[model samples]
Target: MIDLLEIPGFVLDDEREELLAELRAIPGTAATVLSQDMGGRVQPNVRKTTRLAVSPETRERVKEWLMDAKDVLAARFGVALGDCEDPQFLRYEEGDFFVPHQDGNTPLVHDASRFRRVSTVIFLNERSGEPRQGAYGGGPLVLHGHYRTHPGLRVEAPADPGTLVAFRSETTHEVTPVTHGVRYTIACFFRAADAP
Candidate 1:
């Protein structure tokens, strides 16, 4: 009886913490700062993302976790588990942050790549300190648009560990700069059909 109609937070407490700790040591590369747009970009302090290539063991865990989660959500929402995809893990070191923007359309073929539907982010842990940044500022998930139905919408994700958030891919959002430490999380994007 898994409940999943709209957005619901699912904490993978069992091994999420342990898996993230282990992944932290796997080695990461410097992330390129991307230009901001509806196509979200320009994230600093971010290391390697799991979607590219992962170790055999890491890959297995990621696939299994996503598949299981997807199944639960699918049954709850009355949707079939049509397909499962790899999970993405992102690591942000001290001062890492992302600007406001919408997720860019996937590399489209015949304009069909615009298939990304939902974006799910699972907070692994915060190696960073300070519950809240000083008067100066800190990281926050900003999704522009509130009052008037603007182009995009803003939502701040909790810095707490075990936080899982899922939103429509078309919704714009970003992680503000970390005035403090590192941020780690696993993210997966779901689509109704094949990636264009």
Candidate 2:
């Protein structure tokens, strides 16, 4: 079944960390991260921006890790993982904010080439731990309400460093605006399907 699992202190290798840190430090592209969806409308907030990073040296190692995660998930939960690709680290700059939205709940948002069934986000660094250039709210991940026609539930998750959170892509979630500094995270989407 689909659920949210909190894995404590899931830090990558030194090489992986180096690659991510370097990438996040680079100049962003086209706003870098995608802002949160505001009931199908984008309010446009700076607290949310994704780096969507990758390097030739790091992709392979990350891919292998995801593969291992998929295998482990399947064996433990009896869920068939179709494919996993493109591990990206999302960086949210100061004053940035993402609206409330679910990963796969909206067909309106583009779908993944590979079946994206489950989505995972791992925290790279704590917002408080980072340097605060100017005073601002910490970038906290918030869940507005559950996706249900009849009833809805609220989910709130803070972007704690070294924590890995796995949940169905359909979970309604958002990133709270950061008054100052940046929030770093590693994000990935997973698909489940029959064996090839």
Candidate 3:
């Protein structure tokens, strides 16, 4: 089975609401995909989401929270993790989606992302199948199993608000298209402690 760590209530409700309000007010640019030789570029067909420009202070605060879980993540994954990269506040509108892809630590990438040891996503709102207030639909975080062993294995992660899900950087995953409402999330990468 693919290993994943789920931390419920990682961000309290009050704090999550405040952060969401602040994020909604900011404009966002198209999120990019890091290529081996092309640096970061926007490939809408590959990753279609908006990357909110969070303030440095906000980023620092989120990074601190992520770092606080370093030990737990290391023990769970058996990998030494150092610091977390600046978290990206993402907003997915209706129809936006990220096709299947690995986060890092894979031969498919040769950029700074190669240093990523663990990948994480913090959900800012709950998910629902039907349209509802403060909830979204169709944007599920799906994790795939090893292609060689179980090519058809796909696990849909829990999407409770304030929940944080983490997995190995090389694990293949994707955010399915949002069919209705908006989906907000915070994403970051933890680097290997010994990375240069």
Candidate 4:
């Protein structure tokens, strides 16, 4: 199941602006282009976004938050997660989007570290300068849920500042195109380390 959570003052207003500024300062070439398919091909029309680099200090802080979030999820949903990968700061500008895809499957591959058991995305800005709302417009984190009896069920999680959204890595999800201003986020993947 997809979880939409609020971490009050998770990122203070000042901190949010500072981080956003840092992300925007990154040059175009420095940021890696996002891919639509897991095959790792960059298809901008289908999926477009730039992955920004975070400082080592920021990375450490994000990892701590991930672990804290893991504890919260474990207590609420009974989901156990292990080590998390370095966080990826993404900037979605006008016309950027990503098609639906899953992060992992139950079957493990040769490299255990590559498997993602849970995926987390923290909304860093509002939607297109929407007051008291999110950073930009049109871009929403859409999580597709499947039930035994129902299909095509989906939930649109708005990109509200300080909001954290997490779900099973295998769950299908996508980001709708950004119609207006920039949408900033921090996305990370976790491994089910304790599970064989």
Candidate that would win on lDDT: 3
Q: For every candidate structure, what is the RMSD over all alpha carbons to the true structure, in angstroms?
A: 6.5, 5.1, 1.7, 3.9
Candidate 3, residue 134: the lDDT equals: 72
- Give the per-residue Cα lDDT of candidate 2 at 124: 70
- Candidates, ranked, TM-score: 3, 4, 2, 1
- Write the residue-wise lDDT of candidate 4 on 6-97 in tens digits: 55556677877887778878754323322223335556655678777678887788788778777776555456677777787888877888
Question: Which candidate gets the maximum TM-score versus the true structure?
Answer: 3
**Cα misplacement distance, residue 11 of candidate 3 (Å):** 0.3
> Residue 101 of candidate 3: its Cα lDDT?
92
Per-residue lDDT for 11-111 in model 2, tens only?
65564467556766677543333322212322354224755546665767766666677865655545677776467666677666667666663567663
**What Cα-based lDDT does every candidate model obtain?**
0.53, 0.60, 0.91, 0.70
> Of models 2 and 3, which has the larger TM-score?
3
Report how far off residue 19 is in candidate 2 (Å): 4.0
- Looking at model 4, residue 39 earns an lDDT score of 35
Worst 10-residue lDDT window for candidate 2 reads 33-42
Q: Rank candidates by lDDT, best first.
A: 3, 4, 2, 1
Of the two candidates 2 and 4, the one with more favorable lDDT, higher being better, is 4
- Model 3: weakest 10-residue lDDT segment is 32-41
Model 3: how far residue 94 lies from native, Å: 0.2
**What is the per-residue lDDT of model 1 for residues 1-196, given as tens digits with 9 covering 90 to 100?**
1111333335556676666657656775544332121233434334222222347688677766666667656555444434434565666554666555444334432232255555567766653445542111355555555335654444455545666665555555777675655566666666554443
